[model samples]
Target: MALRETDPPEVGGYRIEDRLGSGGMGVVYLARSASGRRLALKVVHAQYADDDEFRTRFRREVAAARQVSGAFTAPVVDADADAPRPWMATLYIPGEDLGTHVRRHGPLPLPKVRELAAGLAEALRDIHRAGMVHRDLKPANVMLAEDGPRVIDFGISRATEFAAQEVLTQTGRVMGTPPYMSPEQFSSPQDVGPAADVFSLGSVVAYAATGHGPFDSPSPYETAVRVVDGDAELDDVPPELLPFIRLCLEKHPKSRPTPDELLLLLRDGHVPEPRPLPTPAAEETRPVRRPKRRRRLWLATALGAALLTAVTATTVAVTGGDETAPGDLPTGWQAWHKSSKDPSVDKEPVGPSNPFNRCAATGRSLVCAGDDVMATRFALADGRNTWARPIDETADDLGASTGGTIIAAHSGRVYVYGADDRPIGHDGMSLTRYTVQALEAESGKVIWKTVTGDGPAASEPGTDSIAIPAGVVATYGDESQYYALLGADDGKVRWKRPLPDPDEQPCMLRGAAGHAYLICTLYTGSDITGTSVTQLAPTTGRPSWTVKAKGGDLDLVGQTDGRLVLVGWTGNHRTVTLINAKSHVLTTVRLSPAQPEEASVHLVDRTLYFILEGGSVRAVDPSTGRQLWKTDSTVERSSRPTASGTRLYLASPSGRLAAIDLRTGKVVATSPGRDDGTLLDTPSYVNAPPVLVGDALYVAYGRRSVYTVDVRDL
Candidate 1:
C-alpha cells in the first residue's frame, strides 16, 4: 500500500514525517522520535506484511541489525515485527548511496575506490564476524556516510539459523536486485553466506571505480547470466587492485578471501583512508557555500551588477595571480639560480654537454650523457650547470657512473668527469675518441683509457670490465686479457691475468668495487644457459672467484657497499641475484614468473627496485634476498620507477604517478595525470625514470612540459 499523508496515526510512538522514498516492498518515511532523533521508517506494504513467511524474514533482519548496529552500520532505533504494517526504524544515514554517487560523479578515482574497497571489507567483516549474512546486500542498502560507509536496510538479511524450507524459499524466490546479485544468490541463494555479501561489495566497488557493474549487460537477464556463467567485466579497474578483487569474486565462495583476509590485502596495498563521518548538519545538506536565501539574493544582485559593469569596463585590467610559482627547496636539493627551463642555445658552452637526455644520480650529483655531447655533471641539489667537454659525437651508448669518476664506453668515447664534471683528458690508441674513458677523483686529468681489438663489436662497454679506483684502472677485453695498473701519473704496473679461453665471448660487466665483476656465460655449444659472475681483483687483475648466479638475460647494476645486485630474467621466471663482492656469496630472490623481458634495476641505498616489461614494479632487499612489494603501474610498458629516501614513485605512461610507501607496500596517493589525454597517447619509445631530488619529483614528458609534483602533498 502507498504511504499517504494520513495513513498512519503513529509508528511505534513517533508520527510519520513524510514519504522519503519507496521501493517495491515498502515505503520509507522521514520520521522523528518523541525526543527528535531522525529516522528512516521502512514500513512493509500491507500485502507483504500479512505474509507469515515474509514477517519471519523481516524479524530475522531486525535481529541482525540490532546485532551489528554501530558506527559502521545503521543502528536500529525501533521496530515492530508483529505490527499491522510490520515496520523497521533505522537511525537515518545521511549522504548519497554508492549508486547515486556514481551516477552523479561518474567513476571515482582509483584512490577513492581503494578506500571504498577497504572500508566495505571491514564492514563486511564486522557483520560476518557477528554471524549474520546480508543476503540482499546491494548499493541501495549502503549509505555513503561521512565517517566511512554504513550498511543499511537489512530487511532480507539473515543469520546461520537456517531451515531447509526457509533456505529453499530464499533460494528460488527473486530475492535480490538482479543488477547487484551474486551468482549463488541468483542460481542457489540457499548456499549464500558472508561471501555473497563480499560478491555484492565487489560489484559496488566496481561500479564506483568505473560507472558500470562488474557483470554489466545490455539487459538485466544478460547481466544475471554473466554473473552466473561468465567472467566479470573488470576492464576499467586499476591493474594493481584487479588481482585482489578477482580473488574476491572467485566462482567458489570458499575460494574467495574472507573479510579478514581482504583487510590484510588492502592493508598491504595501502588503501586510501575512509572519508570522515558526516555530522548531522552536514548530512542534511549537500555541501553549500552560503545560506540558501542569501545565495539567491547574491546571485540576483551579481547578475544586475555584471550587466551594468560590462559596457563601461570594456578594457579589463587582469591582475596576474602568482599561484604557479616554483616551491621552496626540497630537502637534499641544492638552491639553484639558473632558469629551470632549457638552457641558452646560443652560448658556445665548452666541455661535453649532455642536455635534454636521461640522467642518473651518484651520491648527490647527476651524471647524464647525451648525443653529440660529452657526459655532464650537475649538483643534484640545485641543478647547477657543471663542467662539460666534448666526447665523440658518434657515440650512442651511455652508462651511468657508479662512484663518480668512471664513464662506460658508448659508440666510441668513454668520457670521464671529475666530481665537478670537468673533463680531465682522453687516452687510447687510434680509437682514443672511441674507447671508454676513466679519470681520477682529486684532479681533472685523464688516468687510463682502452681500445680493445677491433672487430664486430658485441655490445658497448663489453661485459663490465673497467673498475676505476683511487690510483688504478682495470680493463678486461675480448682477448681474455686483464690489466690492472697505475696510469700516466704513477706509471707502475699493479697486476695482470688472462682467462681460460681468449676466444670466449667478452665478459658482460656485472659490477665492481676494488674488484671488477663480469657475468660470463659459458656456452656448452647447445642451448643458451650456464651463466656465472666472474670476480677479478682490480690490483692484481687476476680471477678472485666465480659465483653461480641465475642464468638468462640479466642486467647487472653496480655493487653497493659490498653486494652485487643482478636482475636476472629467464623465460617465464624473473630472479634478482645478490652476490657479496668480497666473499662471492650468492643469494637469488625470484620476482614475477611472468617472463624474461626488457627490464631495469635501480638501487636507492639499500632497497633494490625493478620494472618488468608490462610496467609492473617489484622492490626487493638484496641483503636478505626477500621480495618487498610488487605493483602493476599500467602507465606505459617502458616507464621506469624511481626512488628517493623511503618513497618509491611510478608514473604510468600517461603521467599518472603512484607514490608508494616503501615500508608498508601501500599506495599513499596518486596524481591525476596529464591534462591532455591525447598527448600521453602519443607513443614514444624513450622511457625516462622519475628524478627524485628530495621531496619534489621532477619528470619530463612529451617535448615541452616538465612537471614537478610534491611528494609531501601526496
Candidate 2:
C-alpha cells in the first residue's frame, strides 16, 4: 500500500517508505533507521494525541511488547512513548498476516497448520513467561513469516503483576474479537491469564484449518454467546488435530493444557504427516478418504477426558525417571541426589511451599542450610551425608519462612548465622540476635562463634546476608549499624566500622580473591535515592575506593578484568558502567532499546551476560558497549547463569539445565527437567546460581532438591 500525501515524511527520525496498515489506534508504516535497519513504525492517529486514555494505552502497549522476545515474536526496536504523537517501531517482518493469507489462498494445509500451532505455542510461552497475557490473539495479529508464524500486536495485553487494574478496558466492555475471545474474557476480564491465550489459539487454528471460525456467527453478540456456551464447529478440522484443539478450547482454564505441554505433544509425531491436496480432476472422480483406524476410535471418547489422562500419564512418565545408564552419565562422574528434608523430623515435602534449602559448593563438599538445620555437609562423589547439626533457635514466622540462615563454605570452614532466640523492642518482635558460627567442614563442629547483631525483623525467603571469601567472613549488622569482617580461622573480628550513612541499606556484598566489595542503596522514604559502591581493604574494613551513583538504580554485578561492572536503569533505558578500580575512571555503555528492565546481570571474564525473564540471553562487551550475541534458551524464569570457559549454564525452577555457547549465544545441550509435582500460584524462586566446579554442575531447585550433572558429557 502506498503512503498518502498527507502522511508525515518521517517519524522520530525514521524515514517512512510505504503504508503497511492502519488500525483503530494508529498507522503502521515501513521505515528504516539511520543505521539502515528496517522497522515497522507505528504512529498514533492525530486525534488520539490529545486523549489521555489513548496515550496511556499506547504506552502500555510499548512496554508489554518490549517484555517479549522470541523466535516467533516480532522484537520492538525503538519507541517514543512521550512523543507528541506516540510511536513504536518493531523489526520489519516481510509477510502477510494469517487472516490476509487465508482470505487470499483459501485455508492452510494440514502441515502448515501444524507448523503454525508449534510456532504460536512457543510465542505464547515467551509472552506468558514475561508476565503478560496477549488478550487479543486473533488471526489478524499473526504474521506468517517464512520461518514460522509471528505473534504481534500487544495493544490489549495485560501484565500479570498489575492485572487488578484494567487500565485499558472500561467496566462491562468487551475487549477482544468476539470470535476468538475466551469465555473468561467476556465473563470476567480481570481474571485472564496465560490460559486465555490457549483458548484463543484453538479458535485461530480452527479458522486456519477450515477458513472460518469455530463459532462463526452473523453478529458479534451471537458470537460472544457461542464462545461461552455453544459447541465448536470442528467437523471440518483434521482428525489428528481435533483432540488437541478440543483440549485447548476447554471451558475451564485449568483443564486446558499448558503451552509447553502442547509443544511436546506436537513434536511427538502423534499428528500424522499432511497429505498433498488432490487435483480438481482427481477430486471429481476420487472416492473420499476415511480417518485412520487407530485414531478413529480414540476420537469417539470425549476429548477432554482423554486429554487429561494423556497429560497426567506423560507427566508421571517424565518425572518418574530416577535412574540412568552408566554410559549416559558424564565421564568420571555418577548421578546422585540427597534429600534436604529428614523424614523422621519434618512432615511436609521439602519444596517452595515449605522452607527453602540453600546450598553452596566448596572443594569436594556441598554445604546446605535449611529450617531447623544450621549446616550440613555432603560428599560430592556419592551424595552421602557427611554431617548435620540442629539449631535450637526458631526463625520468625511471618510467612512461609526459610529460616533466615546465611551460609558460606570455603577453606574447610562453614560460616552460618545462628539465631539467639531472644526477644527485643516493645513490639515483642524477636530481637533476632544472630551469632556467626564457623564450623569445621569435615565434622560440622563449631570451631568458634561470634555475636554479630540483630537480624532483619522479617527475613525474606531468598535473602542472604553474609559472604565468605579467602578465609574472611563479611557480615552487616542492622542494629549495630556497622560492617564487620571476621577471620574465618580464629573467628576474631579483624575490623568493624559504621556504614557510610545512618539510613543506608546494603544491597549487595561480593568477595573475590583478595578484595570484598559492598554496594549500599540510600533510601529517601520509600524510594531509592542513590547507591554507594565501596571496595574494602581485606582486613581493615576501610574503603580503598568509593563510587557514588545517583539518578538511577545501580547494582554491582562483579569485577571483570580489573574493572568494576555496574548496571543502572534510569527510566526506560539501561546502561552498563565500568569503573577502573585503580585509575578511578568510568566508561558507560548504553544498552540497545527495549532491553529487559529487570534482567539478571552476570559478569564472566570481560563479557557481561543478561538473562531476561523470558529466558533470552544477551551477551555484551562492557568496555565497548557492543552486544556480542543474543539467543533464546526456551526455559522460563531460569537462574542466574554461570560460565565455564565459553559455555554458560543455567537451571530453571523445573530443574531443567541448559548449556549455551557464549561465543554464539546458542544453547548446545539441555538435560531433561525434574518434576517434583509442586504447583504454586507463581513461579518458584531460584535459591542459588548454578555451581560449576571441575566436571560437576550442581543446581538447587528451590528447597525441594539439588541435582548434580557432569557437564563434560554435554
Q: Highest TM-score: give the candidate number.
A: 2
Best by lDDT: 2
Q: Cα miss at 644, model 1 (Å)? A: 3.0
True-vs-predicted CA distance for residue 712, candidate 2, Å: 3.5
lDDT tens digits, residue span 11-77, model 2: 9999999999997657899999999998988887676667677667667767777788757788888
What value does the lDDT take at residue 35 in candidate 2? 94
Off by over 4 Å in 1: 1-365, 377-390, 393-432, 438-459, 462-468, 471-506, 512-514, 527-529, 549-567, 574-608, 620-627, 637-640, 651-658, 669-710
lDDT of 1 by residue, 589-667 (tens): 6554333345556665467666665657767776665677777655554444565435677765445677777787677
What range of 10 consecutive residues in model 1 has the weakest lDDT sum?
309-318
